[model samples]
Target: MLNGLGVWDIFLTLTTLTRGYLIWKVVNLLTRSTTGSTNVYQEICGQWVQTNTLTMDNADWGTFVRYAHRVKSIVIHNDSLFGNCKTIDVSILRALSMPPIPPASILFPQLRQLVCYDRRDEIYPFVRLLFGPKLTKVDVRLEASRSAQLAVLPSLAAWCPSVKKAELRVWRERPLGAGGINEVRALSDVVCKWRHLEQLSCGVGCLDDKAILHLGKLNSLRSLQLRISSHLTYHSVRQAEHGPLFQFLDHIHMVAIDSLSSCTSFFPLFSSLPPNITISPYAPYRSEGLCDLFTDLSVHESSGVLEDVSVEDHFQSTAPEEVFTIETLRPLLGLHRLRILSLETFYSFSLDDNALKEIGSAFPLLAELSLTADRGSNRHSKISVNGLITLLGLCPHLTSLSLTIDATRVDDIEPERRPGGGISNLNIDTLRLNDSKINHPRIVAAILFDVLPYVDVFAWEWGAHFDESDAEIYRPRWVEVQALLGAFRTVQEWRQPGFLPM
Candidate 1:
């Protein structure tokens, strides 16, 4: 067992063991030095700390004062921990009451962005400190309180003079012209005084004639977002005529605005302005000429002011054929500058070739498109994937597409089950299809072969009967589908490492 003598062999074995221990000690010392140079917790903790954001509900007055001194921005949202009240009790009030904290500058010298819930009018004086020359943005939500000091507008404007940009949602509209004139005058003064004011967004609880008149006086404003109910009448239109409201607008975002009856109502005033206008599909006003009153504005046809448009329509107790027709989408197709288009709550009158063609050609610059059909109580006609492929042919530049089809009908006791045949023609990189009733390997294979011949990635939701384990058995079918398109031979090209089993 030894090279020459047993004692020599034992000495050699002991020498090797001692060398191994020395190597282990050197590795441990090297690891310690590396760790000392980099501490992961410091990076993580530093990321969590912000210059000036506080959970006022969870923080005390002393804590707020300490952080408020460095805070340049503050955002306070309704939190369950804070008792979920619309209004938060600012620690600033408590701090102000305490042993005359050195001047407010000592407590909050750089705080600028203040976002608060509409608590009451009495909080105005306390808020004034945060709205000095340093303030740039203010977001406040208003609630109805009859006895609050801020029950009127003049008091609010007078309390805060340095608000440059403001977003307010009030419980009721301020009276304009004669009755709300004093409040309007105060607002006018505030607007005039804030030379740097650029954006004003207001959601009125009640938009009356006087309110529109008061809003017309904001000539210096560059961007305006208004949300008012459909109750605004022709009388209110008369009030908007006294002063030009849309003259200086370069950008406009409108929501829940049902009162604007037609382009004639507001566009005539802004004849000289070339503004990028956007209207949320939830707006109440239904366009009289918008293809059978579907309540959508066609950006292609409209002076290109509304560049991107999304349509959401709901039909009441009517058949899909009766609700949506080729004529219904005429206004949408007319939109010119539409680069992104999404149609939700789509009710097709019929899945005819003409209907598909009209929709496909509606948006030329569209790179992303989503069409969602509603699954209502009434039965809906099934749409073939081939029809979608045909649509893709019309939209040549499309890179991403989403289609949600619901073919379930109430009358049928048993639905006919058929394989999903592949779609041919057209080139698209990304596709999402939601089908609940489809699941034949041959059917899926045939469909994928026809559509995604060169597709690198494929994402599909399994039909109702499939689960995780079934994917292994059905995976061969997927391979078959790709094989038909010559994709199987190039297996290395496809990389979907973790697919949810069929």
Candidate 2:
């Protein structure tokens, strides 16, 4: 009787172990089928799934579909998948033709943000598949083609009523034809339906007088970006009897304009904008328009509070001549609180010693400054090494500096002496220099090391000086400079152990 009882206990223990192994095998199979090869998705069966954001390009659709249920945010560029595909595969066509899953049973049920870039025809179907009640942010860029029609933004807005931020870009290779005005009017009518939208950016030719009025009705809107096209003429925007543009400008802190047609119409409205607001234009103003803008800004009381400004010219194949002079920029002296200034031109926006001196005197609190030219031209030859050193001395608080260095005449002129004594240590964190005519790298490196010892990043654009093979030749110079900088830092730290380097 004792032997029989012992045998029965061993049999029960074997059965329990067999059942546990079978359960483990089943779980592994399920995980492999559900999450594919990515280990991050293995534990995505519960609350952990909702924390993930997925970005999918044309080749990532299979992965996207496999884990769509777990993703919370999705950024997809579907242009390559459908835009030029003249013939769709029969299998894919059949899959797309099938009715969308019920809202209750849909994939990406927790998706809150959707960013899509595709042609108009492809964008609609892709958006339809991923639409969810919880989606609150949508950014769509529709590549403009002559065959493509304007996307009805209001209809898109209707699909996602909860969207608080919406950015729609419809860029065309060519200017819109005769019906562009009517298309813009339709867009104006549709945007008013987005009562919950707090931020909206619709690219050029979308903002007309009537549209601005409709946008004004969106009391929830706190930020807006509109491209200044021909539709926004000086007379139309300024002569408005009772439009909300002025009232809307009063509430927003940031305004960005793209492809500005002229500075005359835009600058006059500067007084209406709130004192704290910053204006950033995507394209450069023409030479004449920039002069007018500076002239107007010189006397404006609110210009003092304008802290950030970016000016770039329209990119062209042939380089343009100097667009601005020191005399033209003298008007900007009124901007006392300016901290950030960027002036980028195609090839020839000349800055001389006197101009650098004027800029240094004008904005004493400048922390970030950039004066970049795409290709070095004859106009850039006027900027010498002395001017740059003087400019650096004036703006002691500068943290980032990008300048075009024309070191052709450095040997002829002596380095400017700092008024107090030797070179004062610059707090510059990043230094970008372009077209250094100086052939010797050590001399260039030594000059920079003396003034900006604490610089963390050094970007030298050796345009014609060095080719791919010559990269090895320059490596020693860079290494030497870095070693010197490291030694300087070590000594400084030893001298003042408690002091923090910015």
Candidate 3:
């Protein structure tokens, strides 16, 4: 209970940057520890979910007011907390229309960061109260109508003067042209006030030719995410006045760009690239479009420094894009520093042993590679078990691997029997095989043990997309391979006393 909160604990909470939090999460959005549930959705975090609403009686409020000066961060959910709040102190309801609410009355006066969800009109009063003078960061998700959303933008700018990092997620507030132009202009006005903003996320509508040049001038911006409007086209960003656009950026994520041309044009507007990039389009592009996009990406000055690239879609479209063909992907061959390359689509790669070796040799430091495609045949790729051996030999640092391999024949010159002998990759811990043909389970299992002795995540198709015939043919064999891997793990653990568990 809040009754036990003391000035000493408050001191520690502010000094150590830990204890001052509402609900469960602290300052970090996703900590990725045992308490984090973001990476694995099924992970249960019941203990952390103590209460969404911070309740207080008259005595509790009195005690809370004592240590309020030390509270540094707060996270709130609008579903039941701030929007429908009924138990908060009445001092919050009185919104004084001044720049900084006098220190004598500011609620959580020392609060520096706020993460809140907005759904209704009830959040407006709490925003006035919660937006402390020292707030430097704000992450808001607004799911209200367009009119209601526009009404709150001006208030945020007037209140949160010190905010350096902001994320505004507008969810279905209004249609693109349905009286949204004015709201978009208001957002741009609010954004211009944040001159020192190191990170920002909002709709692409806030960035026009002028705003792009303005944002480019701020060298502190390192990360950016823009949710493209459905009405966006290549022409929308064509008029961007070409200056230093996001040259200091280290990470960028472009989400919901549906068309092929729109995504391509978006890249060239920024001549420099962030080391980490993610392009998530609602629809898949054709092979030529992918080639063109890569061409645009390759012309940049920092292309060699690019470390991670993920081009993914929710579902495989019946587009004409050729999957991972050597000819089509030649533009990306110069990204020698690439460590993570994940291309997820429900199609096969046009990869043979030679293409595979060439690609692997190009990215020598690749640590995690995922080309996990769910398709019917291995005809597009001729990389049998031996080919995998060659690929693994090339990529010595690959730890997590997902590929569509032709595992039909299990013939490999045993590492002991090769000309100079072969060395199996011991770095791989997660192995996910695409829907490739597997005729021999025992041999394949042994081959896998030889290739990736430490593979803990053995992934095969377990989705509802399979037909009865396909399931009957492939499921049991892979299941046997899994069983064998378990037995092999048991035997290996007995031999090597310090290996990580599978």
Best by TM-score: 3
Please count the clashing residue pairs in each candidate, in the order shown: 12, 1, 1
Candidate 1's residue-wise lDDT over 1-502, tens digit each? 2123233333333223222111100000111123356322110000111223222332344444543443466554443324533233344334333423434453445656677653555455555555544667777765434334234344435545566687765444432212133333333344444544568776433333444444455566677665433343335555444655556656665543343343334443443333355544333222233353333343222355544544554323243223344555666666655666665543423344456666777766677675544432012324454455557666766777765322222122112532223334345655554332234544444444455555532323432222445445444544454455454424534455654433
Q: In model 3, which regions exceed 4 Å deviation?
A: 1-64, 78-104, 173-179, 203-206, 228-243, 315-324, 374-379, 412-420, 461-468, 496-502
Model 1, which residues run further than 4 Å from truth? 1-69, 80-109, 117-126, 146-164, 171-197, 204-223, 228-251, 257-264, 272-302, 311-322, 343-351, 371-374, 377-383, 399-403, 406-502
lDDT of 3 at 100: 30
lDDT of 3 by residue, 1-502 (tens): 1334433354444332221132223332122324344332111111122233333344444444555555567665543555433232222222211223233677677778887664555555566667766888888766535566567777778777778899876666332333256655666667766777888887433444445556666788888877553354436345644566778888887765466556566676676878998776656667777677778787776688799988776544565434658776788888889998887755557777787888789999988888765554355767777777777888898988887677776555454564213457788777787666688888888777876777753535643332457567876888888889889989877778677655
TM-score of each: 0.57, 0.68, 0.76
Q: Against the correct fold, how does model 3 do in TM-score? A: 0.76
Please identify which of the two predictions, 1 or 2, would achieve the higher TM-score against the true structure.
Answer: 2
lDDT of 2 at 219: 59
Superposition TM-score, candidate 1 onto the true structure: 0.57
TM-score-best of 2 and 3: 3
Residue pairs in clash, model 3: 287-321
Q: Which stretches of candidate 2 lie over 4 Å from their true place?
A: 1-71, 78-97, 100-109, 144-152, 175-179, 216-222, 234-261, 268-271, 274-286, 377-381, 408-426, 456-502
Better of 1 and 3 by TM-score: 3
Most lDDT-accurate candidate: 3
lDDT value, residue 278 of candidate 2: 34
